[model samples]
Target: MLQVQGVFKSYATPQGPLAVLQGVDLHLEHGSSLALMGESGSGKSTLLHLMAGLDQVDRGTISIAGQRLDQMNEARLANWRRTDIGLVFQQFNLISSLKIDDNLAFQARLAGRFDPLWQAQLIERLGLGDLLKRYPEQLSGGQQQRVAVGRALASKPGLLLADEPTGNLDEATSDEVLQLLLDLLRDSATSLLMVTHSTRVAERLAHKVVLQNGRVADAGER
Candidate 1:
């Protein structure tokens, strides 16, 4: 469902251009999950951002479901992102002012794909039903992250892009959250591309790929 070919990304530095990703190539099939592993400066997040269309790649192509992200205009990209991609970040980016219910429903409503039955299932499956009345600030980190996952999946997007989704939790909580996420993804048949540093986390996915020197150096089924 996703493909990245010869993707190169760099940023302007005081010294010169700082290349983060060079000639990276990767792919994720439909209803499959792939974990992206790399060191701090190895460009894992950069490639994720390129796939999400949050930033344009300096060169090469990122295609999802046959549409080229690098070729789309900002307006089209924005629309595509809203409808096709679900993003979960390390920070658990939830709206503090909104209650859990509102936050969970926000993205689905925005994408015009809200389904009460599906959302009800998500709330139950994610263990979020009791937290609906609470605000983000009132929840623990794990709880908040669960809410974030619920929000991301509410629209039932084709792909889910997660960047260190369990980075803030303890080991037990992280495992709990990861298991919930995997179960939900399987239920929804959504393709997953997650960036993580933990081998344990990577091993849980269907496939794993390591980024070295800005390219996919190793990749295989777990």
Candidate 2:
């Protein structure tokens, strides 16, 4: 459902241009999950951002569900991102002012794809029903992240892009959250592309690809 070909990205430094990703190629099939592994400067997050259309790639093509992200104007990309991409960052990114219920429905409302039944199922499955009346600050880290996941999936996006989604939680909590995420993805048939540093996390996905020297060093099924 996603493809990246010969993608190159660089940023200007005081001395010169520093290339982060060079000629990177990768693909993820529909209803599959892929884990992206790399060291701190290996461009894992850059690749994820390109696929999400949050930033334009300096060169190469990124296509999601047959649409090329590099070719779209900002307006079109914004609209596409809202409807087709679900993003979960390391930080929960929940609205502090809004209660859990409002935060859960935020994205779905924006995308005009809100479904009460689907949301009800999400709340039940994520064990978030009891937290609906609480604000973000009032909940624990795991609870907040669960709310974040619920918000991201509320719209039923075709793809889910996660960046160190479990970074803040403890090992047990991380595993719990990851299992819940994988289960939800399976139910909706949504493709997943997650950037993580943990091998244990990587092993849980269907495929794993390691980045080295700005290129995909190897990719294989787990």
Q: After TM-score superposition, what is the CA distance of residue 104 in candidate 2 from its true location, in Å?
A: 0.5
Give the range where candidate 1 is weakest over 10 consecutive residues by summed lDDT: 213-222
Which stretches in model 2 have alpha-carbon errors above 4 Å? none
Query: 1-222 in candidate 1: lDDT tens per residue?
Result: 999998999999999999999999889999999999999899999889889998998889989999998778999998998899999999999999999999999999999999999999999998988899999999999999999999999999999999999998999999999999999999999999999999999999999999997888899896
Model 2 scores a TM of 0.99
Please provide the root mean square deviation of candidate 1 (C-alpha atoms, Å). Answer: 0.7
lDDT of 2 by residue, 188-207 (tens): 99999999999999999999
Q: Which RMSD values do the candidates have, in order?
A: 0.7, 0.6
lDDT of 2 at 56: 86
Q: Which segments of model 1 are wrong by more than 4 Å?
A: none
